[model samples]
Target: MSGRQTSFLAQALQQGAGALRSRQFDLAERIAGDILKSNRTDRNAVLILAHALVGQDRAGEAIAPLERIARRSDDGEVETLLGALLCKSGRAADGIAQLRRTIARRPPYLPSFQELAGQLSKAGQLGEAISVIESGLALVPESVDLKVDLGRLLHESNEFAKALEVLTIARDAAPGRPDVLIELGRVLILSGDYTAAADAFRHVLAQRPDDGSVRAYLATCLLEQGERDAGEAALRAVMRGGPHLLGRAAFVMAASSHGRFFFDMSEATKFLGGKST
Candidate 1:
């Protein structure tokens, strides 16, 4: 390529990456398209375009470009990304084979296994995902991220008991980490142990006093246990402190249970300084 053309191509790639970071997938794809139009053989441009397509939920269109890069590169990251895109596009079997090949060649790259686990889970290959996660745990036994992911997957698969076990271990290992605590609390809630879930949420809140989600979860547990007044108080506190809290579902349940008139007219207005309808 000529010097000016090369410079333009590089600038296009940079702009595409910037757009991707900003979550402007359509713009990123357009820039990537321009780069590919000039040089279809540009592997980096193809990979960027494929990623943009995937981000835009156009995974089917991503397949060809990603496949081309995967075929030409031995990079495990590239293979894993391509496999993930393929699986997301509903080519589960092909994605699994590609991921397995990549893992077999590079076992130390834990993210590949993590991505494969997610794909397998989404494909309803729960057993396979669990097995892959277990193998990854054996390889990197101290990875808190992997353990948390496994616990979440187990919970989603309705293996609640196993989820609790994995999350408990992770919580014990990483005490005071809000992510671990929140996940453990969520699993406990899924298992219908509302009191335990509430306690876990409380523990997390003790560390992060401003966490509206934790407070809302605790309020939910209280409401579920028929502590209507306390639950309303907690929910009001959350709304007062974190007005933009995203746990409105929990608040709504608490509000409804306490009688909408008292919740909306009395507590909400007092705490939040606005009428609640």
Candidate 2:
């Protein structure tokens, strides 16, 4: 291509990137495809195309384009995307290996570590996930993202005290972050500290009052504390708000009542009054 054609291609690639920034995935894909047709080796275009596919929920389609560029380029970031896409497509083992490779090859990309840990968590490898997150935290101690992941994995692994401690650190790091507060509330509930759990959930509700899930969680805390009236009211509020009942209302109750018993059961039964949902 002449200098003029190369210049045009660069300009077009920039436009494609702009489309991605604006979340115009279809247009970005088309422009990226146009650039690649003229120059198949255009790394930026391939990356943009892959991002566009991912934006459109086509992570499976994104794998090939990203892999193509990843093989030819030493860009650790692009390789991270390939690994993330692989994980999204259910290739957990491959994704984890590729992500580890990406993390090992170049600068410590925080996202790659987080994504790897999340994939490990989903695979029920909570120990591995905790290790990966702790590794990330060692690299960037103040990273709220890594801390949250660590806390969640600890909670999922049934280490409620450890989860609460980690999440408290996260909350202290970002005092007003709702997500950290929410995680704190969850762990508190698991540890049978319903009062503190309710406070945490209520703090979140103060910031986002209409969050039905949080309201439901508050209800759980109340019910678990033997405050049946307050818990019932919270559950009723959720039924009036939306369709969710797990965090919105029924999960804890069902657990306490046994079997499929929930809000639908008689109010005078066990968990509430004794009922089935």
Candidate 3:
């Protein structure tokens, strides 16, 4: 391409990418289509077009553009994006196979494993999701991402003991990791070990003192263990916090008054279930 043409294409690419990021999917699609018309083989333009289509709730339309790039580019990003698109578009089995193939071809592949596990879990293939994450962990034993994801999946499947084991390993692997600690505390809470869970929550609070959710969790542990005064104090502190914290506090307050506070830690603390605004 001529200098001016290349410059123009680059500018178009930048604009399209920015538009996609800003959720101006229609504008992004227009720019990406223009770029692809000038150069059908432009991988980035194809990717942008695919993304815009998917953003616009036309994930079905994204397949062609993604496949076009995949046919010519051996890039991992293309494979991952294509596989995830396939999964989101209701071709989960094909997506799972492709993601597995990508992982097999390259050990410790991050995106493929993450995407495959998430899709499998969402599709109710709990065993497959666990297997995928286990395979990734085997390849990268120290990967906090793989371990945490596995733990959370185990938790979702109601395998609290197994989830606790995995999360403990992840916590030991990286003691300073807040997410691992949080999951660990949650599993402990669900396991009927309120004291141990409270200790874990305290450890996390030491790390992230301002986390109102964690504070609420600590309060729950204390309350369950018959420390009413301390729990109510902690909850009152949450009520005095910012908007999100106040919402959580209100949830707990209302749940307590309504006798709905008997839910297990997962149900009680889940932002989804309580959904405090």
Question: Per-residue lDDT for 76-126 in model 1, tens only?
Answer: 877888788777777888988889988776446788889988888877888
TM-score of each: 0.73, 0.79, 0.75
| Clashing residue pair totals per candidate (backbone < 3 A) | 0, 11, 0
Cα lDDT listed for each candidate: 0.79, 0.81, 0.81
Best by TM-score: 2
For model 1, the superposed segments whose C-alpha errors exceed 4 Å read 1-12, 37-43, 190-196, 202-215, 224-227, 237-277
Clashing pairs for predicted structure model 1, backbone only: none
Q: What is the C-alpha local distance difference test score of candidate 2?
A: 0.81
**Residues 74-189, model 2: lDDT tens digits:** 77778888888898898977888998987675457888888888888888888988998898888889899888888889988998888989999898889878899899999998
What's model 1's lDDT at 89? 76
